[model samples]
Target: MTENWLNQIKELKQAVTHSGKFHADDVFSTALLRYINPDIHVERVNEVPEEFDGLAFDIGRGEFDHHQEEKVYRESKTPYAAFGLLWRVLGAELIGEEEAEKFDHRFVEPLDYNDNFGDDYVIARIISNFNPTWDSNENSTDAFWKAVDWAEMILRAEFEQIFSRIRAKEEVLEAAEKAEDQIMILERSMPWKKHVKDLDLLYVIFPSNRGGYCAQAVPMEDGYQELKMPFLKEWCGKSGEELQELSGIPTLNFVHSSGFLSAAGTLEDALEACKRSKELGTLNEGKQPVLLNVSHGISSEWSKEQIKAAHAYGEIIDFMLPKIEGDISQESVENFIDDTVAKILATKASVVYCDGETYLTYGIVRKLKKKRVTVLGACHNLNHEFVEFVELK
Candidate 1:
């Protein structure tokens, strides 16, 4: 038979949980129940009575608890805490399934991981701290209630953001459909990038909450620093009449110096700016590509398969050997790092496969990032010999 109690949770009057130290899993579970039925009474006890029939979780080794010898786990292999098990059953009933799934991934899974495995999160830590200290005079029951109240605020905030994103989707999609010359215009400001990033859009124009309309470049690929097409270099950092004069857009606010974002006083001006930018073409159209290798112990550091992986990102790998014969000094290390970065900018290989001493790699990566060079890192899978190149953060 179906669980009449679970189905009739809206009418639930009394709930119970184990008495003792509390955690986010149990705290959030209580907060969620309170969110559903504000008047429901809650009890924390060491043991539940046989005749007592009420919502029970994180205790009694009942439906919600996973402390038993055999346990239930998510398909992703994350063990379900009391909170997660509750969410899995009733989350869709509260919010639609899609949004519930998102909430579970964002909030539930992390807290569940903290409860099941040793993974830590701020929510878990804060709730755990709510438990009275061994020497504290504070009441445990009061502390548990305080923690539940905080979890409710967090849960409410997450739902608000999720709902806002959902609302933005339809508006973003409509604008994308009406896009002209690779430009999308939003009627009001909302998050638009995630919805249209994969679309054939070079620029997006939206009403800025700070006033005026904003025009922005689309990234070449998500997480890539490069833009599909950046705004004109000449218009960058120009504002007021200066920007208007350069672009012939009558009402201009300011065009950022980076050429990735700009604000115009009117929607017409924003569109005009995007149109002019498309005509100007990409900046540094002929900036060379280089593949420089400046690491000590090249042959030993890299396998033949790893060397082949490096070549996939860029063509030539000029293995520039280190120049110190005896003990190396800090100055020599600095020189090697500086020379490597400079050579990379100069050759057919700013796009790189970087491997070196930890400190040297750090310096090289920092400098290359500033110059807008793509940095590559290796990822090896279960098949040890196979190596793949991926963009490094």
Candidate 2:
């Protein structure tokens, strides 16, 4: 029986190798499936892109009529509403607690929508809430729920195949326990957290599409360039700039370059741009601080110049939260700013850029003011030359 199980494991591993979306447990599930059905076919699961449109959102509307008799209508705005619903459903499935101070990384609640995102910032909120965009127009709300139900049917069948002929519930519980143990060991060994502490300064570059790409596929420049914005030129370029002039300084230690050059690229390419930004930073000799960036909404090819400069710097990426959002208030943005400030404090990051006002929320500005973190807000209103520098009070 052990030999048969080993053989099944081998087959499952092969299936996972071929299946792009297969996670570690998927391998175990595959092995179990093989045991249940000798002729089971291992097919790769299709994963929808995290950034997609067409999500159906339902916005409750009230009865109002002027020219005609008032009649109640179901105002369907599923795209927006979907974020809340998806978070409720999918957020519940994440694995919580691993190696922690409590017990082998205490299992936090599952990475639900709220856990992954917050109302403080809209972009993070949107991404955390919505992963798979639903085709709301094609299917009614009831139909979508029905589809979910049908999907679960396939899931159960797959689960049965993966579990094999397990006669007792206790055995299933044991398997779960063993899996949890392995996860704890892996979480503690993550290198990013350790290095953040060791490094003295971190440079984060947010790539913008200003001159990088035309749509999502076209390019403006051949490669990235050094920080040449009027603000960077004034701050990083100045020899005897005042603390007031340096007010535009997002950081005394770090530099930044972000804005979409173009929009014509794969999500993978966008993610890779973040990786490249870190690499570029490493070229500079020093503490080798971390450099981070996000991908989405690029404008031109020349923008690659910034991404290339970031690559030369050898940047380190910690979090890859999606740029998601909803109609959020200044208070919420401020709270997010405070939370991010806490994270920066924990890492002991001294000089940090708040990016710019384009992506900067009023909440973030207020948080910086309270914490005394130096940040610069690029004022496009002033020929892109003037930067509103915020000093911590």
Best by TM-score: 1
- Cα lDDT for residue 288, candidate 1: 31
Q: Tell me model 1's lDDT, rounded to 2 decimals.
A: 0.77
What lDDT tens digits, residue by residue, belong to model 2 across residues 335-363? 66567656655654333334433354445
Model 1: residues with Cα > 4 Å off, grouped in runs: 1-8, 92-103, 118-122, 233-242, 279-393
The CA lDDT at 3 in model 1 is: 57
- Model 1 residue pairs with clashes: 289-348, 289-349, 290-348, 290-349, 290-350, 291-349
List candidate 2 stretches off by more than 4 Å: 1-286, 292-331, 347-351, 356-362, 369-393
- Quality of model 2 by C-alpha lDDT: 0.30
Clashes found in each candidate (C-alpha, N, C closer than 3 A): 6, 91
Instruction: Residues 154-197, candidate 1: write the lDDT tens digits.
Output: 88888788778878988889889999998998888888777876
Cα lDDT listed for each candidate: 0.77, 0.30
Cα RMSD (Å) between model 1 and the true structure? 6.1
